[model samples]
Target: MYLGIDIGTSGVKAAVIDEQDRSVAEAAAPLAVSRPRPQWAEQRPQDWWRAVELTLDALAADSPAAMAAVKAIGLSGQMLGVTLLDRADRPLRPALLWNDGRAGAECRELERRFHDFTERVGCRPMPGFPAPKLLWLARHEPAALDRACRVLLAKDYVRLCLTGEAASDRADSSATLLMDTAGGDWDDALLAACGIARTMMPRLVDSAEIAGIVRAELAARWRLPAGTPVAGGGGDNMCAGIGVGAVRSGDAYIGLGTSGVYFVANDRFIPSRFAGMHTHRHAVAALYCQQAVVLSAGASLAWVGGLLRAPDLSSLMAEVEAAELIPAETPVFTPYLGGERTPHDDPTLTATFSGLTHETSPLALVQAVMEGVAMALADGHEALIESGARVGEVRLTGGGARSTLWARLVAAALGIPLRLQPHAQTGPALGAARLARQSVGGPLIAASGSEAIIVPVEPSLREQLLQKRALFRRHLHLSR
Candidate 1:
């Protein structure tokens, strides 16, 4: 058996996989993610650790045999979250989340400082990336930055807390926008451009490489055997790819989480200077993958659901899906609930529910929200293709994948088939499980599971969505 744990934004999930790559036992525990201020999201590193400990204990309690059967432990987690830790492995400040947009000025400064070395930084200038967050701390929270310690992301912090060894995986480090996506090493030139020393980084390792075992005290407290091998796991998105058998070249994953993404796996690195697409190595092996993130995807429907105060999410989607939305109407939505990541990478962008009148029903409004998100994802997909990456059929996952209407609309907007997965799990925990199996010389990919599939079914809606998408482009406005 292998243990796979996902350190997520709102929770932690631990799963024990049997020899057959099936989850024999699993447990999840939720934690609080705070948005203390607008455009600023933070979480304590301890929260993720505690969530992991509790979930692990629960899993062990449920299956005593799992304790001895576990051969290796793997991790998957939220990407781009910034955690500053001291030499003693203590957190000096709250970790900045992936969605936080407080580093705008810092990002601009970085762009100015690294005009000559932009290509070395792995990706384009984006406010939510870790480098800018580090700059933000250096400028605004200098004491915290000066505490003289390592800066790690969410999963790396969890690895440090468990093993007392600060380390990072290629997949997670890719999100920092600081990794040499092509070279597969930390770009010292980019690090220097950010004014940070090399010592500040943790030891880099492959996703499958074993980092360390559980510390004795914690292992005993969590009722686990000592010296359990903890495999280096990729960032959540990469893990998702692993979970769905997207390990080979040309395999693609279209994630519809809070943000939407069209991820394509490639054998070699592909750079897009204008498209701003991410060129990062695959967490499982030597090949690289290019991922394009839409600023807001599932977030649009979630926001609308909350506004409606719908008792159940599925009911809300169904209710909206049953309604008819006129194609001629130009209801433009930017889907910028939390700002955006791909193409524009703008924080000043605001959302709109334009082309609205008293005649627009609540259900129609909901349909419009889903359509808007689909259009945004299509925009990212097109930009990436324009940047010269070969586009292929998209495999879908995440909460938004549950909506048949949304998936078909997105498919039509992108004019590609959107096939679903066996399980619609977007959690990195599953990804970690897939990685754990791969590390031990199990199956090289995760294609033989109880996977599900969703194909496009609505052409009329697709045509309407395509037209609305064009109108949305015409109306897109950015203040900065």
Candidate 2:
């Protein structure tokens, strides 16, 4: 058995898979983001470790035999989070997450200093990236910056607890804006620009290579063999691509987790000229992934559900499907709850509910939120195409894949078919497990043969959606 662990924005997941690529057992534990300040998101590094322990413990308790049989472990996590550690490996402060937008000014300053910043980093420096976050700390929280001894991404911190190693995969490192994306190593100039030293970064390795061995005591506690190797896995999107067999150029997938991503695999590094599109290394060597991100996708639905006091997201979506409201009459929503990324790198943007009427119900608002996210994705799709990234049928993965109605809406919005595979929600963890298997002399798993294809909406519905999408774009422009 091979094990995969993913430290996500909302939770930590552990999955165990056998040699045949079948999932043996899985477990997950919830995590909460601390948004103490508006436009700022932080999480205690210890909380990630605690959540990892909870998930692994649950897996060991439920499948002791599989846990014991585990040959190698791999990790995947949210990308670009800044986790600073002191000399003793203790967190200097709460890690700044990818969605945090408090460093907008620092991003501009970095670009102003480095005229070719976008060319070097593969995209313009955004507030969500670690480089800008580090610059922000240097300017506003110099004490923390001065006292830091190491900088680790989200998953690497969990790896430190598991193996006592300070290492990161090249795929994750490339997104930090501190690494030379083409060279696949840390760039001293970039580090110096952010007031970071080369020694502060973790040792980098390929995603499928063994980075370290699990601590004997922790291995025993988790029912794994001593000295089990931990593979240098990758950022969640890279691993998700592996899980869904999107390793080849033109193979694309849409990740609908806490944040939404439209990922297309490439054989070479193709820097995006389109604003907010990211070009980063893939977990697979010699490959790269171009991404157009929506800062909020499933997050928008969750927000509205909480505001309306809905029982849960699934039930709320069910209510939306049952309502069958007319597209023309439904309120239009702009899902910029935490600002946006693709096409417009604006951090000051806010969500809006336009065209609301007295007769509008909670269900209408929920439906509008879903449509708004889809429209946002459509904007990303256009940007990807404009940047010369080719996308055909896209595999839909993440928590939102469970909703067929939403899938159809996204398909309609993108004007492309969406393929849904079994266990689509388990993409990242499964990809991590796949990477672990590869680390232990196994082949990359192929995409499953069984998949449900969601085609675009009918002509009439598509035309109505187009109209609503136009209105959505208009509102976003007016808001800007």
What is the TM-score of each predicted model, taking all chains together? Answer: 0.92, 0.98
Worst 10-residue lDDT window, candidate 2:
446-455
RMSD of each: 2.4, 1.2
Give the Cα lDDT of each candidate: 0.76, 0.89
Runs of candidate 1 with Cα error greater than 4 angstroms are 221-223, 322-330, 446-450, 478-480
> Best by lDDT, which number?
2
Q: State the lDDT of candidate 1 residue by residue for 353-407, as single tens digits.
A: 7887877777877877877877877878878777666666568887678888777
lDDT of 2: 0.89
Question: Number of the top candidate by TM-score?
Answer: 2
For residues 29-148, write the lDDT of model 2, one tens digit per residue. 999989898899999999999999999999888999999999999999999999989989999999999999999999889889998887787888998999999999999999999999
